[model samples]
Each structure stands twice: as C-alpha cells, then as structure tokens.
Target: MNEPLIEKTSGWRGTRELWIQAAYGALLETGIDAVKVMPLAERMGLSRTSFYGHFSDRKDLLDALIQLWQSKNTGNLIRRTEAYAETITEAILNVFDLWLLPDLFDSRLEFAVRNWAHSDARLAAMLEEADIIRVEALQSMFERFGYDTVHASVRANTVYQTQIGYISMKKDGPSDPLAPRLERMRTYAEIFAGQPVTDAEAARFFARHPVNET
Candidate 1:
C-alpha cells in the first residue's frame, strides 16, 4: 500500500510529492510519454482507485514537474549568480556550485526537459525564456564587475550555453574525477569571468567542497 503522507487517519491516495516523484522517475528513465497517472500509480504500488486527490490530471502532474524544474534549476542558478562574492571568479564559482549539488540544479531532469522540448512548442518557448533569464542573470553578474553590456552578454551566453551543451552531452555518463575537475575549474573560472582565480579563492572553494581522495 502507498503510505499516506499524513498520519494513519489520512486517505491512501498518496501525496502529491509521491506522484510527482514517480512522474520525474518515469520521464527520466523512459521519456515524457510514460508519465501518465495510471502507470505512475502502478509503479508506486498505489491502488489506482481514481485516487488523484492531488493533481486533477496527467497534465497537472507534468506542469508540477516543469514548475519544479523552473524553481530548482533556473531559480537556483539565478540566486547563485546573485550571491555575494568579492570577485568575478568567486561569483562564477558560486554558479559552479550547481554542477556539484544536484539539489540546486538537477542535470538529469534538465536533459530530459530539453529533449522533450523538441516536440513541445510550448515547452520550447519556455526553454528560450529560461535561457534568456539565465544568461541575463550571468550578464548582471558580469556587469557588477564593470564589464560592458556587450562583453557581459557574450560571456554570459558562453557560460550558460556551454553548460547547457555539457548537460546534453553528459547524459548518464560518469563525471570526470573530482581532483582533476577541480583543477580545470581554475582555468574555467578565468575563461568564463576573464579573471584569474587566486590561490586563496581557489582554496576556499576546494575546502568548501572537499574530495575524499581515497
């Protein structure tokens, strides 16, 4: 039986989060087409008693998924770019934290959404809007460092699109080792921010994100 999110007194229909999680799993594993409510209920071991007490329809679930993506992925990225930092490199490193923390930016969901957009004009438009919002946030970060609007736009596009491309190509692939990846981040910061990462700056980041190195 699907455990009720509430106490024993609650209904057995399962919480909205359960359905959304199952929908995300299905979308990531198979494709968007597999995210119907009945199959999700079956996968969740729920009774499938027309028990959609949360979302009214499959489209409702899908909208929930997209809203979650918007909040986690794009919302976090914007907040990162806006986070307090002493230098452009530090600012960019703040943005880079998303690459490490899936809680901040779920790359698998992002990839699936991008692929889904190919056949979804509405989603494709939303994607373009999201890209604009993301790049503009990066641009604003650059502007804080005294870059001209043109330079900021170019650099922001470079950083944002490069990461998007990386997500698309990195599907289901193991990431490169952390130590080497950390080393390359120094170079990446300089390239993206047009500023070198100081040893102190790099040390702060490395210390914050420790590698087991075992």
Candidate 2:
C-alpha cells in the first residue's frame, strides 16, 4: 500500500506560509468560520499547539488572511493596471485581464474575502480600502492616457463597478468559454475607455500576455 505523503515542517515545527495556505484553502472551500486553528491543524494532521507558534490566535490568523487578500489581489491589480498602455482602452483591457485570469488574481479568494467582509467590521474596512486602491489605479491609468481628472474619475468608477457587479452577482450553469468571454469583455473595455480597440491591437495584447491554464 502507498503511504500518505507527509507534510514536512521547518524549525518551529511548521512555517507561517503553511498555516496561511491551509487557512486560505479553508476560507475558499468552506467559509471564514472554517478557518479556525483547531480545524486547520486537524486538516494538516498536526495539533493545535503548532498553530499558535505561527499565529497568535484566531483573530491573528484572520488578520493575516485579510493582509494576504490586500497584497495578492489589490497590490497585483495596481501593478498590472499601472503598466505600459498606449491607450486608455488598452489600459482598461489590462485591468480586465487580471479579472479574467485566475493566475493573476484568484476569483475564488476574492469572492471568499467579500463574503467574509460582510460579517466583520474591520475586514469590511479593509475591503473598502482595497476597492479605493483599485479605482485609483484605474483613474491613474486614464489620466496617463490624457483623460482629464473629472472624466478619468468617472471612467474609473464605471470600469471598477462593472467588475464588482460581476463578482457580486449569482451565476447558474457553466460560464461562457474563455475566448467568447474575452471578446465580450473587449466590448466592455471599449465602452469604458470611450474609444475603439482595433482587432490587431487586441490580438497583440493577447499574444504578448497569453493566458496560462496550467
């Protein structure tokens, strides 16, 4: 019979990243309530004592989760949106690419964090801060493309809100395949930018930043 793989821990018996990853998995699979130390330790085939070695308490673990969401989702989006873009339309598309690609930003984690935000006031505040950062990144992108402050702000909110709505809404059945969905979102990009994105430009963008499935 094959033996179950054992998870090796470093000096302190386990690393902080191990606990954080297990907690993240629980948060995404079940919910925030499932992220308790005992449950996570049990899942890892370890005792609760080792959890305290990494996190101070349950609240500390929760805070770490929030911080992870802020850095992974918000920080990454800001970097991608603020990168090179010859036009506002391409900039909008760049931001959209983050949402479409799970490797860039994990949508499951995003939905989980949003759900957690509803039950915790402190986390809700962090969620709001992340939203502001994303909007400001979009606005800055528009400004760089020569849009005035007023127009940039409006366009930023428009693009950001549409994505928020998509995440918040309930869906049934299988989602549209990637190619068609990207095509539809390309139309949204044009509308949000108040400009047209030619087929050649869109193709170039996709070719340069091909979506990785593995």
Candidate 3:
C-alpha cells in the first residue's frame, strides 16, 4: 500500500537522525573512550565507509558534533536573553536558568569534551572561546539592566562560577538536589539586586532582539 511505502521512507530518515543523535548521546553517556569507530558504524547498521561519507574521521565527527551543540545552545541562549532584557536581576536569573536547565546536564558530553581538551589544543581553544562568548552575553544583559561595566563583568563571573559549582556538585553528589540550589541562587540574586523576582521581570529579561551591529 502507499501508506506502507511512505512509512518505509520515513523510517530511513529517522534512522539516520537516530544515528547522529546516538553519536552525541554516546559521547555524553560515556566519554570518548567508548567511541569506537567500527562499533558506532555497526550500531548504526552501516559500514565504516558510510560513516566516512558523513565525516572524514573520528576527529572530524567530534568537531562537527561540538559545533552542532555550540550552535544550538548559543542560539537558544541568545533568543531567550533577547526576549527578556529589562532589569539586571531578571536578566541574570534568565542566564542562570538557561545554564541550569535539566536537559543540559542529562548528558556526559561536557565531561567528555573536558577530557578531550587536555590533549587537543584546538578543542581547548574552542572551549575557551565558548566561555568568553557566554560571559560577554551575560555582561551585555547586565549592562542593559543598568550596571556599570566593572560591576556587570564581576557579577556575571560570580553567577557563572555559581552555575559551574552547581554542575560540579550535581556530578559529584545527588543531581536531584539542583532544584533547591537553583531556588537558593534566585534568593541570593534577589538579595544582591535588592528586588523581588517577578514574571514580568523574567519576561522582560528573556525578550529577544538582534545582536548589535558593529
């Protein structure tokens, strides 16, 4: 039947996407140590050469995957931040929330990437650049909220450090504890900014706009 044929075609497309998704998932679930080229090919039900058609080699694949993640996360952050750029406190909290989203930690890709960075200078440089981008984004939001340059930079770093600490704790301890910690973070931000958190505040902080043209 036509329906059966259509289903089969859709299945192939699904399979390819699944393979790509699995590659990232594997990296997150288990570090690069688990990423054997032959095994991944077999898992995808394809020959090793087929993978080469998609990527030149393992390193190539890794680079592509990192770029994909960076693009996705950066876009999401930019869109969300632009949507809500009103007050300093709201903007800071929005940044924190995006960084601490539950799905962000559900994978081991960050850990795997950190390990990869040790030997791969290129990867290390990319990670550093990503950090700078993130910090700058936060700083810009702070400036929109009326903070001076020095204070904005300092507060952004503080918030960033706190999020990193939370991630470290989630890895070392019970991740289920993150929600309460996030709440505490909000409380801390409120105290520091001397204002109550509000939905309008969050909305203004998350409002989207174009990146400034140089």
Best by lDDT: 1
**Tens digits of lDDT, candidate 2, 7-123:** 655544577888888889889889999998777877876667888788888899888888888887888899988878777777777787777666677777888999998998988
Which scores better on lDDT, 1 or 3? 1
Best candidate according to TM-score: 1
The candidate 3 region of ten consecutive residues with least summed lDDT is 1-10
- Give the backbone clash total of model 1: 0
Point out where model 3 deviates above 4 Å: 1-16, 100-107, 171-179, 191-194, 198-214
TM-score of each: 0.92, 0.88, 0.73
Please give the lDDT score for candidate 2: 0.79
In model 2, residue pairs whose N, Cα or C atoms come closer than 3 Å (at least 3 residues apart or on different chains), thus clashing, are none
Q: Cα RMSD for candidate 1?
A: 3.0
Q: Cα RMSDs of all predictions?
A: 3.0, 3.5, 8.4
